[model samples]
Target: MNIRNEWVSFKIGDIYFPDPQQVAFERHKDDLLDGKVADLSDHGLLKEVFAVVEVEGIEQPVIVPVDRLSGPAPEMSAGEE
Candidate 1:
C-alpha cells in the first residue's frame, strides 16, 4: 500500500476538493480555486467529515473546501525567493 500522508489522502494531488461535475465543468474553475458545498455518500452510508463544513443556516448539505494561501512562516520570510 502507498504510505500517503494524512493531508494528501483527501486530495488526489489536485488543488480542488473534487466537487460535483457541474461546478467542475460549468464553472470552469481552476483546481486551486477550491471546491463548493456538496453532499457526499458511499455504500449507502453517510460519512462524517471534520475538515469540510457546510454553510451556516443553509439547512442543506454542504462540503466546501478550504483555501490555504501559499506563504512561508514569518521567521522564514527572508528566505522567500
Candidate 2:
C-alpha cells in the first residue's frame, strides 16, 4: 500500500460510530479515528493517522477504511509557490 502520492482526506458523519465499543469491534485501524484518506482500496478509502511508533518491532502506517465517510471529498490546500 504505497500511498505516498495517492492520499485523500474527507470527513465522516459524527454519528457514524457513537460508541467506543463500535470502534473496538472494527478490525481496521483508521475507521476508529479522524477522517483522513491515506490509501484508496477496492473496498474503500483508507483513513490516515499521523503517528511515529513501532508495532511489533515493525514501523507501519496507520490506515483504515472510509466506510463512515460522508458528503464530498475535501478540497486540497494550495502548496507553497
Most TM-score-accurate candidate: 2
**Model 2, range 20-80, lDDT digits (tens) per residue?**
5565456455532333344455534235433322223334644433454443323432341
lDDT digits (tens) for residues 1-78 of candidate 1: 776764543333354655555544655555333223334334213334323334445465444322332333354456
Task: List the pairs of residues colliding in candidate 2.
Answer: none
Model 1 RMSD vs true structure: 17.9
What's the CA error at residue 40 for candidate 2, in Å? Answer: 1.1
What is the Å distance of residue 65 in model 1 from its true position? 1.9
TM-score of every candidate: 0.17, 0.21
Error of 1 at 22 (Å): 12
| Predictions in order: lDDT | 0.40, 0.42
Q: Could you give me the TM-score of model 2 versus the true structure?
A: 0.21
